[model samples]
Target: MKRRTLLRATGGAVLGGSVGLAGCLDQFSDSESGDTDSHDFPADYETETFDGQTVPFAPLEDVAEWWENDEARFVDARTQVQYDEAHIEGAVFSPSPDGLESADPVAEWDTDTRIVTYCVCPIAQAGQRAATLLDNGYTDVYGLADGFNPWRENGYPVESNDGQASLSTYEIEGETDPADAGEYALAVHPETGQREASRIDADGGYELSLHFVDVPDSSLLELRTPSYELEGTIEEFSSATVQV
Candidate 1:
């Protein structure tokens, strides 16, 4: 049997200028922001009609029950790093955007398998992922109504790499030196060969606070810009950092 690999974001196109520094940092928040409140689902949340099919939202309790019974598959619709830092136990990593096309882990699941997609966003990414799965012939797909935050808040089971309960933050400070550096990606590499990247703000000075699962001190970090790419291990980064 061929082992499946999670899809990775590649090229400058993956960064796409849509996410800003602040928005990226917000993913590590312990609680959901105000924007999430409006989209929170009640116990009596209504199902929506999509593509002539009635799609339902899976309440947190329902998801918890299914998880406890191992009756449903949980898909994380955030970035791989986010998934690694902390995720519901047994949930699969399937980041949004390129994930549906590149990192589709459920491509071989039975059509009747109960699948639940969840994200920290305002019901946008998770809902889209669930809809896409439904469009692709999945019979029983549902989006987690309030996503992982609420589940975590309710003292549910979550697993983290490196034994940390939450993601570890690292402040990456460097100088691109070149004034014309437009945009760049800072990638964190764990020993397991998974790469998590975020767009770095290039204006003024170059500084970004990155989050990661338990990255061993021996893991590698890379900085990629339009003109150049530099790679080094975390040990070197701690002392010298990435200097372009």
Candidate 2:
């Protein structure tokens, strides 16, 4: 969605009054002066609409500029493991739906503050996180258009704990009871502190995506849903089908 909603002010002069609206004009001038210090995003950015929520998607190029200037708060929407492995430097690790928890730095930001969110899935998780911010009354929020993959691939600034470790994405999907629709599905690795969450679709299906960095085959993973939980090794979980 390459569109912008510009605010317009309409006014007319009253000829009969000799005294001008000086106080109101002064107040408006002060507000305008204050706004000049705040950062503004360009109008040509894209947007994504998911699950009835819409959020603007700013290209990595633009985001990089903001990052360099420290003009926006960067939020990593990936799991703790993914974030720990690699993330845009200085990014806050705040996963979606739970992003605004008191523990996250974003929780302390003002509603008018500029925020950018990103995930390895490119726009999927980032879009969700940005939408969540919009729902929470964040006026200026954007999703990193191509996400962390491109940023990392293009050699942008990033903080990595295990740069030599190979990163892999695994998608585990299965059906759930109809009653469990709208609930959350989570994949958790207790030892590594890796966790991923996805909302169960209305059709009783869900795909929980996990990003791992050199995860051991013997590592235990807990696949959990509102109705049931299954524990198995990482290899087992990669091929297992969750049914509840």
> 226 in model 2: Cα distance from truth in Å?
3.1
Deviation of model 1 at 122, angstroms = 1.4
Q: Show the lowest summed lDDT stretch of 10 residues, model 2.
A: 15-24
TM-score of 2: 0.63
Q: What stretches of model 2 exceed 4 Å from their correct place?
A: 1-54, 68-70, 99-103, 107-110, 122-132, 135-137, 161-166, 178-182
| Model 1 misplaced regions, further than 4 Å | 1-44, 48-54, 97-103, 162-244
List RMSD in Å for every model shown.
10.5, 17.7
lDDT of each: 0.56, 0.64
lDDT of 1 at 84: 68
TM-score of 1: 0.49
